[model samples]
Target chain A: SIIRILEERTEPKRDLEGKKVLVTAGPTQETIDPVRFFTNHSSGKMGYAVAEAAAKRGADVTLVSGPSQLTTPFGVKRIDVTSAQDMLDQVLIVYGEQDIVIKAAAVADYRPVQTFDSKVKKQDGNLSIEMERTTDILLTLGQRKQHQFLVGFAAETNDAVAYGKGKLERKHLDAICVNTVGKTGAGFQSDTNEVIYLNREGKEQHLPSDTKKQIAHRILDEIVEDMEADRK
Target chain B: SIIRILEERTEPKRDLEGKKVLVTAGPTQETIDPVRFFTNHSSGKMGYAVAEAAAKRGADVTLVSGPSQLTTPFGVKRIDVTSAQDMLDQVLIVYGEQDIVIKAAAVADYRPVQTFDSKVKKQDGNLSIEMERTTDILLTLGQRKQHQFLVGFAAETNDAVAYGKGKLERKHLDAICVNTVGKTGAGFQSDTNEVIYLNREGKEQHLPSDTKKQIAHRILDEIVEDMEADRK
Candidate 1:
């Protein structure tokens, strides 16, 4: 099936023998106590798939992952982090050298204002934890981004497209992939993803649902094509 | 983080306790042969998170899942399937009985025109496989839907909002989640997601980087609020 799709892909496979691709995956864990933490449901499948796809194309791939049970794809470097701050720090270390950067991790938006050394015992009374906002990784990357291509994700439930467009403008991304959460099978941990590709030029391409591997291929294909067009 | 987010949620919990919710997840595998098949990277994380969130709020949840490695969330009735046709059949069977349907699975837009029972050996240097379009599940549901709230996902790489809005109208969805690919830390398998909720009324709400679970809760909150407003 892969061979068949490869054969049918009209776009020529762009060689990335020496290109460096960096990706982030999984959900960051924000600690609330020694025994408890805050996190998301990300399984790091999409980011790992992207890394694998990049490796398949002969690119040097580095994947910075959060907490997830999935194994690393073959021929890719993996780094694990637990919090959004940690993820941001790791990304900064490699961001400068990469030719491409894809952020697929669902970093926590906020963290416990104070981490308790011990877990709070459950009592009959109610308990509360104050939260503080985490850093904006996309915006920060966009601010520091150089010649490298940057892509961002906008997961929307309502007016998905409009908000995605806003992000594209605000983040100064080369392309953005929008997924609607309102749909049952398309986003998050689903093995299949159906997405539309939006480029900086406002061109739109809709990718039908397929495996993350195939979707990753198509996404990279678009990125390579966009790069080639930029070069021209 | 779950308890913190739940406490912080602007809307009350239990709002969807009795609400009948339907969700779809994972990628439909298209068979090329008995030994090989085609699928995507969707792990069904986002949809599953939403299902779990709805269940937490006491909704009667029915999750229609495609192939995925993740375990089913507790208290959520699960139905597994492969291929787009199987998904369509399940959705049609269950959608009518539900009050809300979230189409999150990345349904395949195309499938193999022919499925060979035996593996096709690499006999010739080149082989061609015919392709055919799968059913448009969202559109079909939208057409027959009466009082049920429908949501669709627009995964775009370009013109994210315009395309998303187009999909919302085309599918007659109450709302749509738009997500862009190639971002640093959101979408697909990542646990943390950043999305904008877009409603039919053109109102957009931005959700910064957070866990898919939190995002799911926010989405459900909005949906419940919208439903409440409609009743008023």
Candidate 2:
């Protein structure tokens, strides 16, 4: 009975085996100095969860991660980088000819323009670091997206759905995941997430907060379904 | 000079110092048995990141978390939970009289109808677990939302903009964040996330991929702005 059930559940509805999937994870470090740097609260849990889920679904996966304590999931190729620029470089290099690309890394939007060879000493009261915008990886991929799926994230505290929708249009993304911060257990380095799935046809599916692995499966299922519908 | 520059950059906008903010994070475990359980890939990073950011902004925060290894940020009241129903119960107790409610926790859409107290051994060839729908936290909150700002997330893989806008209208959310999961390095456990903000008025803003902290700050700033605008 168990084998039958497993077979039924694990049976591939779509031929995802051998499909190339790429992912990016962890927080990008914007260097202020060699010792002191700017990063975020991302621990690479969500990205790793998705990578694991994809691998379980029998897809070939390449995970590009920033520095974090998370271990690489089994059967997935892993790449490590530090800054957003580094992430962008690695993504471009690996993203070629992939059927799917998941940009789950929390890349820094701005980085210190100049890197000091030595650590900047903490002087008196406070410190100010001149910052400049990093490359827009999603937009770049969107511009170059040929036959692959393009997705982005909109993490907001206010007007989340409205902002997410705007990003979907502006970046030409097939879908987007929106989350709110400044609360308790929803964002950054936690082990679960609650999100709503918004599709191009205006269908909104509200997924209750669940583990990243389950969410990843649901997300991939949706993607596969959407791709099929697109073909149809 | 650094302190001066830092001060110039840190212009005080809206103070949430004494405000009570409630948040939910992580996925609920629908137990199949004591040892075997069903869950998702939620790392609770987004919610936790938001909580840390809020605490940094001097807000008195209450974080309701599912199973996660994340350490509570300094100056935050944390509550641990497991199932969606448990999260809902905790949220109800804390949500009332709060200044803002960010439903960032990804509650499971379904739970096992009956959970086995002991681990179900693999005696048969297959096993099945019955599931039932969990509570709709956002919809319920939207219905009961009084003066508090209510925000939701829309994670869509297709028709992202349309679905996000629909959620904004249907759920009476103050705002929503939309993100796509199919892209590389954008959603879930990645350290960097790119998102879009959408308001009740349908106005949208695009935030390219960045650290969750910066995105959290921007989201909170927008929330304050929206609050002020609503008051007017």
RMSD of each: 20.7, 21.8
Query: Per-residue alpha-carbon lDDT of model 2 for B123-229, expressed as tens digits?
Result: 32323334566777887888888888887776655676787888888788889887665432236666666678888976688878887767777777877788888
| CA error at residue B117 for candidate 1, angstroms | 0.7
Error of 2 at A204 (Å): 57
Chain B TM-score of every predicted model: 0.92, 0.90
The DockQ values of the predictions, listed in order, are: 0.01, 0.01
In the range A2-45, model 1's lDDT, one tens digit per residue, is 98787568553547779999989987877654433555446677
Query: Residue B137 of candidate 2: its Cα lDDT?
Result: 82
Error of 2 at B40 (Å): 1.5
Can you tell me which runs of candidate 1 are displaced by over 4 Å? A1-232, B1-12, B183-186
Recovered native contacts in candidate 1, as a fraction? 0.00
Measured with C-alpha atoms, the lDDT of residue B168 in candidate 2 is: 82
User: How many times do residue backbones clash in model 1?
Assistant: 70
